[model samples]
Target: MKKILLVALAFATVQFSSAQVETPQPSPASKMEQKVGLTDVTVNYSRPGVKGRTIFGDLVPYGKVWRTGANKNTTISFSDDVMIGGKELKAGEYALFTKPNAGSWDIYFYTDTNNWGAPRKWDDAKVALTTTAKVEKLPFNVETFMILITNIKTNGASLEFVWENVMVEVPFTVPTDKKAVANIEKVMAGPSANDYFDSATFYYDNGKDINKAKMWIEKAVELSDKPRFWYIHTQALIYKKAGDKKAAKKAAERSLALAKEAKYDAYIKKNEDLLKTL
Candidate 1:
């Protein structure tokens, strides 16, 4: 029993010694979220202090690809597709890399994000964008690294970085107007054939008003210049459920013909099954 207790005490001591203690990091992790127009922009990075050391052109090294922050490679994510310096970037997460110079900083939006600081091998093709941002010398130093969405507008914003005594910014535009205008036109023009078909099917499936579903399905078929087989099949089902046997039979036949032409075996089988029941 004494031996067993001694062994257990040793195990506990080893576990206690091996256990990690929580402490503050030299460069703390930080996350920032901002909305650039309709787009949701997010930044995940580590902020390292100047610590009274020389930045840019010295410690950071000029004309070298930097991680843009400490620890993990800094990442930025966009919810909507955006335009930077008239160049379009698809909506996704990107590693933020930079090459700082005396007068300017070459900013990079890299496609690859999973890395510690800088990537082992830098591939030019992985760079989504490379834009030069002019560095503005500040009167006073900014001790900690800072990134802010400055110059906010309805359609765009500036991604400003501040560290040491320098500040650089890259301007990006979001397609708020294009998206909004398209949505407005769609709503103004009226519900599309697919919209009617979807509504009709939803009503039919949910055991809603069968007559209303019949009307919507009829409108869907009429509005379609060349109505799809699946649309017609749904229409047939809706009509049958609405107790319109003649309309159901005609719609099923039309659906069967369209399905055969389109080589859609599933819709053809569905139409044939529906017709037998009718």
Candidate 2:
């Protein structure tokens, strides 16, 4: 009986030792990542120490500019033109930096290529954009630096930043449809006109006003015969809508001729079929 009891005691001790020796599973960390633009350029970075640990002046140092976060310089690339910090940034990558304070912070955009360090040498930067942030009046400590984009719209967006007892917001605007249209028209009026014609066709396919569509197609037709098929097809549809059978037939024939020359056999066949009914 004594030997059996000793054997059971030894087994319990081994089980407790095994439990203590077991390796602990690591807790997952949330990394910052976002996507932007038509091609969906991915932006990713690590969020380092923030609130409870003490940042800026205590952990990060106040007077010096910080790289903002660790691992890869907090890159943001635009697939197209974007207005950031009230200034236009063309499609490219930029390194982010910040000047921190208790009340407000100055956000900076560095054009420097190497994103390894913070403000090592600002003289090499191409340009810098400054924006002010409004700090909150709360005593919550942040453990990780963070950024979020909210209230996104076609015309503009709000870029937000948060850390420790503060939050900053910057309003950013993208090119509006009206502005794009005006710019396209200006480009069309330039020396090489076909480029503009292509632009008009793009706008039309995207559901622009029919009257504007008709006007742009007319401009395309006047510029060169290269877009003749598109212009003729559009004019034929317009004529059909206006109940002008004679004009519709003429335009359809023109479209068929242009399509045939361009080896657009499918377009030629479709336009010819429509012409037969007229």
Candidate 3:
């Protein structure tokens, strides 16, 4: 019994020692996601507090590359291609690194995203983009590092980084105008059959000119190889509103036949109701 008790106690001690406990991190992981124009941008980093230390010159040290954030390297991801600092960056994830100075900061988007800290050996080949941003002093102190995307516009935004008493802004633009203009051109070129059908339906429902409604519905039917039952029903409604009883009855019968073939019970009932009205 004594041997068994000792073994059980030892096992309990091992179990206690092996148990994992959760605790707050000194520099906690953070994430930010924003959409600028048609591009989706995401940032993941760890925020380290100032903790009463001088950040720029003393701890971070100017004229040398620094990991943009704490612990694991900072990462920025873009869903679509973007123009930053007059250079185009392709859609992908990048490791963000910075070399700070008194007047300006050099920002680097590196292809390598798996580094723990600033890459020990600098490789120019790994750099996807390099840009410079002017630094500005803030009036008040900031306790922790922060990254903000602000000055949002339809096609661009400002990516700002703030820490201690300094801030830097990087301007980026997304190519949204090309796609927008293409869509506009496509829409201006011509309307689809569905567009014609919807226009006719709207005109008929709003008690507009019956002749115009009939004209649009006829175009819709001509566009469709085999017109839907709803299209024929809409034509019947337009004819009925125009006081053409024969034409209305003929269109309603066509709609009923198509509706029956499609096994559309609701449309079949609608046709039956419309025929009764005629």
Candidate 4:
């Protein structure tokens, strides 16, 4: 009986020690990052574990629209107009929400500033938008969710959400060129007439509308008593434009002198090179 007991004790001790062997646990989760601008907003939501199980209501409950993450509600702020899932939204910040389903998910936009849980208080006012989901043959889980805004242009853009077994895409189009320009005029409390003149000179070098460039630069020169080298160069261009080579040469000489006095090496070099062409 003692011998049998000793053997059993040894076996038990070995089993316990083997079970005690440490197994490595996975590292901590990554953070989410996003950027928003006048034209486009990008979101990068880190994938949370969906495990090996079928997601949706199972791990992340159904019927309820999740806040999408733990932090401040997935929010995108816009300074200009944007279209999401074919729905036009005026320029403003909005909370993003989604209703998970067995087949497809409904994306939502809440203009309400408050974001804690699913704020059902503002239910009727929420912008509900639906998008279709395509089936993936193989099951892949997303450990972190990521959404990105890309292909951004002045008037149109796309939002791309990528994750386990799914990619959600939404296309949007803004207003036309007139509207865009007007918006810029409203938003940009911009540079002065002097700045405009400098811009004109730079544009003239780059083969821009020389007439308009000359007009803006002349205005700039009129505004500033100390002749700016840029406007001086632009003045040269005006002379050159009018087919007066002597006057162009004289303007270039004046520009070179001002550039030297101002210790502007780059501007001096640019004007010196331009003078060679004249």
Candidate 5:
């Protein structure tokens, strides 16, 4: 009993010694996702506090490319292509870099995002889009660095950066109207041939209204520019189920010929069997 007590105490000591303590990061990481119309926008960065120090043109320095955030490269992603400074930026994730000036700031969307801060060797070709933003002096100082998406409209939004007593905004437009029009056209076009055929097949298989199935199968063939042998074969089955013997016979005969032309033996056999029943 004495030896067991000593061994248990030793094990407890080792467990306690190996336990980890959680702590907060100096510059905590943050992520934001927002939708501008149909476009998805995502941003990931680290927020570093001012801590009562000068930011731009001093610690951060001016006329040089800054990481735009602390730690890893600040990244922004777009689901669709966007227009910035009247130029197109392809849909993708890019590292945000900035060259600050007293009056204006040059913003860059870089193709490469795998870096601690800005890329060690700057490549002009990697810059997808470069835009200029006018710097505005704020009435009050901001304690933390932040990039805000503001002035949201149906077609566009603005990216506003704030730190210290300065603020800057870059406006961008998304292809919202183009996507919306495309979506509207697709919906207004009505049910496709496959849609009608599938609906008819489901109804026939599940023993639903045979009349509706017959109607849909006929529509399926009518909508198709060139009707398939399998579609005509299904139509024959639906018509027979609906007790339209004459129509079933006609559809089956058409399907048999199409199947022979298409060299589909299985459908040919099925159509022949259906016609014999009719």
Candidate 6:
């Protein structure tokens, strides 16, 4: 009985020890996210160490498609359309693959984002964007694979990859100013009812031109089927500023009725205050 009990206890202990053991990974996963202008850029990859081996032409053979990382295919995500290497790429996620050489590196953006490393048989039809970047030798050795977003500006940035003694940079541009200016021009050409109301309120508050304020506020009220309490209140204020107490009191009363129906306490109080002054 004692010998049987000892054998069972040893078996249980071995099972627990085996379950607790953890193996280390040779390459570890990493993620980077950045915002350039109004666009968001993200990268998911795995980092492999140098391990004292020649990287460029020996381990990661030259003139071959690399995973751009280790273990899994590297992925890059863009939130907005951008111009990369002077080629337009629509906003989306893509797998980053590369072909390295002594002089230049060819960077590929593939639509296939869920593959393990660079597949032996990758379809050329899956390639979305391809660009070439000049290879530059680094002054110091990088012990591990590194990816960086550098040279950040309001309209563009540079994506850099560094490993061992090799470095490559891919430049991209965002059309921030162009989009903003176009939107501004559009709004300026066609002013909405709210724009007229806001301009009237600005003019009335600043004591600029009472007649102009009245014209704009009237236009705002005319355009609205059911005028807002705030707009009616602004109309009352403009009348009061122009020294027309009767018209001001009438507009304030209308504003109070709308405020009560909407259950807006702040507008109700403002209308009451204006009426009291009249």
**Alpha carbon lDDT of each predicted model:** 0.93, 0.66, 0.93, 0.66, 0.93, 0.92
Clashes of each: 0, 5, 0, 7, 0, 0
- Model 1, 139-193: lDDT tens digits are 9999999888899999999999999999998999999998889999999999999
Candidate 4 TM-score over all chains jointly = 0.47
Candidate 4 residues 1-278, lDDT tens each?
Answer: 99999999999999988886566333222333333333545342334544566556565676677766544566766655666656667777677777766556667767774766568575655663445443232365565566666676666666665555666666666665756577789559565666777678677778877777767777777777778786777788776875767878888899999999999898898878878888
Backbone clash total for model 3 is 0
All candidates' TM-scores? 0.84, 0.50, 0.65, 0.47, 0.74, 0.62
lDDT of 5: 0.93
Better structure of 3 and 6 per TM-score: 3
Q: Model 5, which residues run further than 4 Å from truth?
A: 1-19, 201-205, 210-278
The C-alpha RMSD in Å for every predicted model, in order, reads: 3.1, 11.8, 9.0, 14.3, 4.9, 9.3
Q: Estimate, for each residue in 1-278, the C-alpha lDDT of model 5 and write its tens digit.
A: 99999999999999999999989988889898889989999999998889988899898989999999899989999999999999999999999999999999999999999989989999999999999999999999999889889999999999988999999999999999999999899889988899999999999999999888988999999999996989999998998889889988999999999999999999989998887798
Model 2 residue runs over 4 Å out of place are 1-42, 178-278
Q: Model 6 segments beyond 4 Å from truth?
A: 1-20, 182-278
Q: Where is model 3 poorest over a 10-residue stretch in terms of lDDT?
A: 174-183
Best-performing candidate as measured by TM-score: 1
Scanning candidate 1 in windows of ten residues, the lowest lDDT window is 226-235
Ranking by TM-score: 1, 5, 3, 6, 2, 4
Better candidate number, 2 or 5, judged by TM-score? 5
**Model 6 CA lDDT for position 215:** 90
> Ten consecutive residues with minimal summed lDDT in candidate 5?
269-278
- List the pairs of residues colliding in candidate 2: 50-142, 50-143, 51-141, 51-142, 51-143
In Å, residue 15's CA in model 4 sits off its true spot by 45
